[model samples]
Target: MKRFPGKTMGLLWASLLVCGGAAAAENFEQCKTRLFNQAVAQGVAKSVATEAFDSINYVERVIELDRSQPEFVTTFPSYYSKRVTDWRINKGRELLKQHQPLLTRLEDEYGIPKHYLLAFWGLETNFGSYKGKMPVLSSLATLACDKRRSRYFTGELMTALKLIEREKLSTDAMVGSWAGAMGHTQFMPSAYYRYATDGDNDGLANLWESIPDALTSAANFLNNLGWEPGFRWGREVVLPQNFDYRQSGYSNRQSVSQWRQAGLTRPGDKTLPDSEVSAYVVVPAGHQGPAFLAYPNFRTIMRWNNSEFYAIAVGKLADQIAGGKGLSASLPDLPAYSRDDIMQLQKTLNSKGFDVGKPDGILGPATRAGIRDYQIANDMVADGFPAKQIMQQLKVVQASETSPN
Candidate 1:
């Protein structure tokens, strides 16, 4: 899972101890004694636990690392195109050749196909070429100290500490991503506790140093998430003429049979199967672009990352890894509008007695309904999606109404 930025468990506990008055110190001492007395807590040897904690300082540089994600705001094509480039594909192929036996064994054991694993590895760190340079302990501990989501961060921090106590990971060796996600596939502290395994059989699930453990852990995670071995995530679908534009969001789910009845079909196929599985259509742009009928697996991918564009990018990368061509659908010509602009548009519509719902920047169903109402009232095409022209018109109307002649 992509680790959300927040306080770490260590910082939370520390703050509680420091700020909870004299009682806090007493409680801390008691808890420390109890933790130390409990044998085999984090699976680490007892000898290194106190010493590691005593010397480590929660560095503030970790904040910079967490915030420096330049690629997060980029267009999907730009971000994905770079990740799925020939260099990555060739490198992935090379890694596959070198580790075929290990990958084959993992696939057999975990029932997760190898391509998805490769896709994650290739996408995450370019096959471990760049796991991250930050110290996991410092990064996690710093976030924990900040008291941002102290409860959650404290849990993760405790987990990390437990890992240290168990000797499963050496303090010096536990380096990882900016947000404290370690190894090739970027397993966070919580994930390390749950899914990490000793694939190389070195007595520890050392994701930083061992490729086998990282890949195995990743496959284990996906398998546990109900990934189907032979089933595809999604395929491009063709929308019929005069299709309801509002039915393009992620929440729109209909069975394949229902979609067929509604005149939706796969891009190249004429007939739709009468399968009971639910699916939804997403048109990244307006009607001018290619569309897709996303299946349950697509939602699963979103569970890994909340962004629609990110999930689609990962799916595209996985297809590329499997030697399939990139998305055949053309993106809509609509230049992306700023998120702020979208929010402002929603606010305007809501103030005008259109129920845009919550004024969130997301162009969701309620927002679409509001846009449709506005369009109908103005005698414009009720296409639902709020284009630049609609926003401009709203601004002009607002300005005129507010003007002091």
Candidate 2:
């Protein structure tokens, strides 16, 4: 389910620009001026603050990207196929062997598996081949000045300034994603402060240029996030015919034994291993699609990236790198919805007294619950998937209301 933490920053900024006209730009400049003062108050050198902010322009592109993260809209199958490809897997394997010595050392020290590290490296920036080109300072400043998620981004901006001060990094050299996630494994500035490591012992983390530093920092981050050394991330499991669909998702967690007792098994009907480990069932594409019993380590992966699809991709990619089989089941051919459609759906559900909160175009938990309630009332499968059928049904109802009466 969708979970946007705040209002769309881009839309908020756009509305401000429209309402305030030229005043918006003036207000932004004023905001930047105040940010400079805040930086100085936070112990950033006045010269450093000036230098970082002087030539920085509000990167409109950054706002656009922040608003339209593909993971929010794309189906899991579409997203998964694009990321966990044959080339990536082959490259990951090659890198795994090439960096065996370094990975082995990291595993020994951090108690995290090597393949998972490779998976993160592969997925984050395509094995360091593309760490983005946007200036981190400008992107962070742009986002921090925006109303949405300003508190978080402002703190990140301060941390970035502190990073420059402590690490003695050139602001000009600090290039990364539109949201200011930097380096090979795309660590946010705060994360860089907390977990970045000098793997090569050259007195710098150097996630930009040093593979060892990037990979080591990744391992350290996961380890600090509580990565279990020996346990696998999770495994694809086959549910029993007519199994309860309500038992799926991260909320309905149970021990491995309990799930096995409830008729969950490996894809080939193999018995689950005798373990006391707790896991939750996740059916990303609903009951008709493939299911997985996500282990505790899966939660650890979620700490790295909160998205279920992303966590699954990393785990499955790592599995492939470790010589495991690919997914046996295919994704169902379900019709996709645009953001506007989702917003309309939420609005319609709210009109029907479903209480979907604000129609923010995000299918969050509340929206899903509303959809499920609607489905249950209409005697449909309450999967909360928001498929094309629901959208069409809503459209027909709207048409009826708007027609001559």
Candidate 3:
């Protein structure tokens, strides 16, 4: 999958690329025709567009993977364990030394640290061990013909065609996740079009083949996403026993000194950095879980992946690879939720007048806020995390809800 929720282009640019929102109802052949037309209309040469179409087909598995994307399904521990492993950290440390010269240059030029770039690489494609094997053209085309995200995927499909024409890449080697995110860092075609760099002086930015090119392109993307030079992503903190959970969360940002005054301290009870940097406290696994005071750079990580779980995983994995202390608190064993379970929670919350704004199974500020409000109203802890107890109270799950098979 690609980094999502980034502002890749303007509404006008997207509108220009999209002409097939209603193509879902049409047969694959018909939708394919519309897509080829849209690609040509967006300035992809007709020859290039036709060649791409000849190699594309509707992939049933792509649509299945899209509907059940791990982003919408996995819980924090499940996501973290799989992503921030010892192998990735150990390998990343070796890579840091192996590519020292290039990484240093990239940091000097792009202001993104080597560890962060490496962290993204480990998380995105396991340090290039597996850069997915799905056919990119077919994946994007299938998604473009779907009703749910046609406009967005249609735009990506058109850009993928442009990338092929520009790079003269073979469709066979241009494989990626079912979502059409390509190469080592899993960049969508739009991101590829914008930030790809020719780091190896190969006269092309081939993210799939050139390690230098992929790393440099990743650095460029992070810099564009607002990475701050010489700043840490965030740090784990020990919250006061009587800390008010309501004050926790991204929206309720406060100065570091203010948080220090409010009894937040480093993991060993050391005083905070004493800076006036604006920061927010995030208890990703809830009040019982660990806490981190997120900084501006943390939001920059979120731009790379809007999911708080993924962002935190990136930070923790980077720290581990750098020989930093791991989390002070062990992750509590929690039940993993399927989309249907979350949808049920949303429906239940709406019935009680929380109005979570139509739950699409993805956890966001609205759902967290709704859960917080509901908890407060019912005289429960207002940490905004949907623990199993709260789930039972809301009747979103059974007495023993386990993960989906």
> How many pairs of residues collide in each model?
14, 0, 0
Show pairs that collide, candidate 3: none
Error of 1 at 242 (Å): 1.6
> Which candidate's TM-score is highest?
2
> Which parts of model 1 are misplaced by more than 4 Å?
1-47, 61-75, 333-336, 357-386
**TM-score of each candidate?**
0.79, 0.88, 0.86
Error of 1 at 369 (Å): 5.9
lDDT of 2 by residue, 238-334 (tens): 9888676666677888899999899989987799987889998887776667888999999999999998899999999999998988997888876
What's the best-to-worst order under TM-score? 2, 3, 1
In TM-score terms, candidate 3 sits at: 0.86
Rate residue 88 of model 1 by lDDT: 73
Among all windows of 10 consecutive residues in model 1, the one with the lowest summed lDDT is 68-77
